[model samples]
Target: MTPVPPSRADRSSPGEVLRAGPLEIHATARQAFVNGARITLGSRAFDLLLMLAEAAGRVVSHDEIQARVWPNRHVSETNLRVQVSTLRRALGEARHVVSTVPDRGYAFTPFGQHAPEPDDAPVPGDHVVHVVDDEADMRDALEGLLMASGWRVRTYGSVGAFQEALTAQTAGCLILDVSLPGENGLELQRRLLALGLSLPIVFLSGRSNIPIAVEAMKAGAIEFLTKPAAGEDILAAVARAMALALSERPQSPA
Candidate 1:
């Protein structure tokens, strides 16, 4: 198997092996092997795969993909298509997980009848990310990555605690788990919305149900991620969430 060098995303991860059905991805190492044999991926292909993997199931648009893969220069649509084809070859039969949405973008599954469209609304102030996940490991992992990346962060093991904290400090973004002991992330999101709290929400889940993801998107969640997602993907989502929060932030009196 080929030894894949670490990427920026790997530094924040625990170096554990991530399993998605038959594929094995080493997050810390930035390597993928199938049946113990290494799969070769060009730099662009790897970046694309990592982005999709971290999305947790959200459809990543062509523009977003280009921005990630080619941050500076303009990449032609043909180039994007070529890179996608290459990634599909690497995934082999498992590639079906990456589904194309004509006129929209690419999603991780075929179950979604439509695609998520991000708003450019702006909010202001520090973009603190408030994370709520029952798993201590998950919470720590996110905190380490987000804080190290220069984002302000606060974490809670439950929605109630996060809610309590919100009264004092409004988080610019919220990263939450779909499953919790009581009052899951979706419920908390609804509650927040009712109270006029529209912070960008990003959902993480080990149990991925398409309908539920759709529901979260419908409720205005920035993104819904499935478990074992790459830290890079989480970071990308957080960036998006923060941008939304900044746009949505109320205007201060001039």
Candidate 2:
């Protein structure tokens, strides 16, 4: 039998499988696996990861991200960061594999990992609460309290569903979960801004971490209530959100 030439066996292609820490990336296949389990990564993110991994260890500048990710079209750095955030969340335990250099571009550095957990509690009674939480028990608990207080409520488990609701009827306010399965709260907030939906947002978090709360407020949330907050506190937040929403609504021709 004839042996294959060294050139044929030594070449690497973009289709070759690449590894960054625990992640197994197949650029050609347009997919990735973590610890042997398939994980979801958006198309833009998939391309972003390929570019970063191809860098080996050198930082890829913001200009490079734009050229590669949005070539021939302009995109804001925020848009780029949103994709990075999604990529980081998808990376989960190995999120540190990607690094963000201060005042510089991101780089491919497979040197870290991360973890996750969940919690519970209740708050808020309102007009169309529009809860976007995947956790049913928590959603039900909030529903019970809000209904008991004579407040209307609507619940959704995904951003797509909530967006559908937004199209159907404007809500008084949105009670958003920071840890939604996809897009999450912050990402949703940005999307809402892009869509010109200024509906007041009230954030709910079980952890109630200060930094998280600060971020929520910074994103224009009417209030940031930790889980297990008093029924009255929830109602108070609802009132604030509703009032703000009402004020923002356009007046009918008189």
- The TM-scores of all predictions, comma-separated, are 0.54, 0.48
Q: Lowest lDDT 10-mer window, candidate 2? A: 1-10
C-alpha lDDT (0 to 100) for residue 78 of candidate 1 = 45
lDDT of each: 0.71, 0.69
TM-score of 1: 0.54
Q: What is the Cα root-mean-square deviation between model 1 and the actual structure?
A: 13.3
Candidate 1, residue 220: Cα displacement in angstroms equals: 0.6
> Could you tell me how far off, in angstroms, the CA of residue 177 lies in candidate 1 after the best superposition?
0.4
Candidate 2 C-alpha error for residue 28, in Å: 71
Worst 10 residues of 1 by lDDT: 1-10
> What is the per-residue lDDT of model 2 for residues 104-212, given as tens digits with 9 covering 90 to 100?
6677765432211112122233236677887888788878988887668888888878877676246568888888876788899888888887778877777757666
